[model samples]
Target chain A: MPERIMPGGVMSGVIEAVISLLLVAGGIFVFIGSLGMAHLRDFYMRLHGPTKATTLGIGCMLIASMMYFWSVDGKPDIQELLITLFLFITAPVSAHLLAKSGLHLRLKHADKTQGKPVELRPEEVGDKPVPHPDKGHG
Target chain B: MLSIALYITLALVVMALLMNLYRLTIGPSLPDRVLALDTMYVNSIALIVLLGLWLNSKTYFESALLIAMLGFISTVAVCKYILRGDIIE
Candidate 1:
């Protein structure tokens, strides 16, 4: 491994190692998350993967980005942190909203899903009157 | 080492993006497609960050941040539309 000599004579080997580790780890998590998104049998089941796993994956990558910029610029970059915080905050909220919308639509769930609702009648969904995708269009 | 790691990460993120595309394409219901899109945004953020590191470019930082902000807003808006049949009502 060739050593990288930073502008200020900073020892870059350790920082680079840490960055590389974080990058590789984050990449793997990201791939796993996407894999789950693609291969899952049901919508709710598919929701489980990217919401949590990909958020953490990006968080790892952002941290490595922070470290890389900090080492090069000789100052900690707060922008990456902003993204990390934004993603962490929004990921769950979006997931919740997605699930709620799914519920509102009475989307089908896999039979094997533990705790799957036995039935979702339209009236039980409340006064809004759930829009039936079939009756409205076809 | 860092560049090599960046390249590897870039490839992985690209693959992730492709998988997300697959989900978006075949999602059976509206919410499913929306979820796929939301995941796509997050994956793209990772992709942008990886590119920034690979090119040693500082300009990509703002773009990444912008993507994060916009992606979240769009996801929320679309979800709200799905739930209420309208965004602002």
Candidate 2:
């Protein structure tokens, strides 16, 4: 545990302002993501939002946190960095997996969603493409 | 100043969680539900990090890290099960 540094100056105020800005921006992005998830008409379109939340939204908040701790503790906290990196890596992978599964399940897309996957066969997906619960629907 | 911003962000995140819950409850497809869950956990991590900042403690970072790892693994596992019928093959 590093000794807390109580830096009382204009820099402190500036850092706080920055952190506040980051927090508000991150919050807004997160809200927007969820809003899209809730209101978007199709599964594929819905998937578009959360990836933003996971990357930019969480990324902003994490940076603000790192800045917060560094100013207060006088040492850069690496845990937030770890989370940021892990999210940047895993968010895309999970999104890919979700999209793949969606395609496997034949999830319906909005009519406007373009560049649909063509000729995706079930056997081509996995060793055995499991019969999904929503097998009958589009 | 910091506290005010934290509160507003807190409210936004909590609302985000609620929206996620709504999607989880009524998502038309399995992947949508899974995506909702994934987003839920990520939002929770943000909430946890914010809590740590508000309380001025460092302990929450470990929990946030753990949640990130677990969330990603669970999502991948569920997706694998959905695709292949078996989790580990």
Candidate 3:
């Protein structure tokens, strides 16, 4: 009963309230990000959706989880910390690779897109193609 | 009070996953499908972590971590295959 009574004060109530708000905020961000991904007109434009908002959304959720564990168990959950780090690192890399593949395929561009990359013919080269730097290993 | 919040968060995250599924199925192009799949996995990870919070169980922690790792690897591998026509040199 003493342990239960210990966590029922005004300050703890405030902390729990904040955690609730964060959970809602994070979920909302995730919902919006997915909405953009599904509704966007072009693949390239869709790439922007999950990369930014979703990453932030998950970050907020993890932070709330971390705090919750700390408050309940009296120990910080370091795994959430590691997960946050991994997520931030990977979200961009995946987005970049997806976009890169789309560009490599020369997928259709939106009507107003500018600065589309032009494929240069072999004869249009400014100079001879340089040999691979590591080809001597052969 | 906290449980109610957890329930709402769970509902929203599931809705996001549903959107991802919609994109994956209705995709016009292969890369678009791949992108949807990638987002789906990430959303699942968030869902799993949220479940862990609600259950207050440490068990789901490792699973969430593993999903994060595996999801990233699979996404990158698939993207590479699309980009280069092969996953390895």
Judged by lDDT, which candidate is best?
2
List candidate 3 segments past 4 Å from native. Answer: A1-11, A119-133, A136-138
lDDT of residue A80 for candidate 1: 92
By lDDT: ranked, best first: 2, 1, 3
Compared with the real two-chain complex, what DockQ does model 3 have? 0.62
Give candidate 1 misplaced runs (Cα > 4 Å). Answer: A1-5, A115-138
Could you give the candidate ranking by TM-score, starting with the highest?
A: 2, 1, 3
Q: Residue B14's C-alpha lDDT in candidate 3? A: 95
User: Can you tell me the CAPRI class of model 3?
Assistant: medium
Clash pairs for candidate 2: none
* Model 2 CAPRI rating: medium
Docking class of 1: medium
Clash numbers, per candidate: 0, 0, 0
Residue-level lDDT for A63 in candidate 3: 90
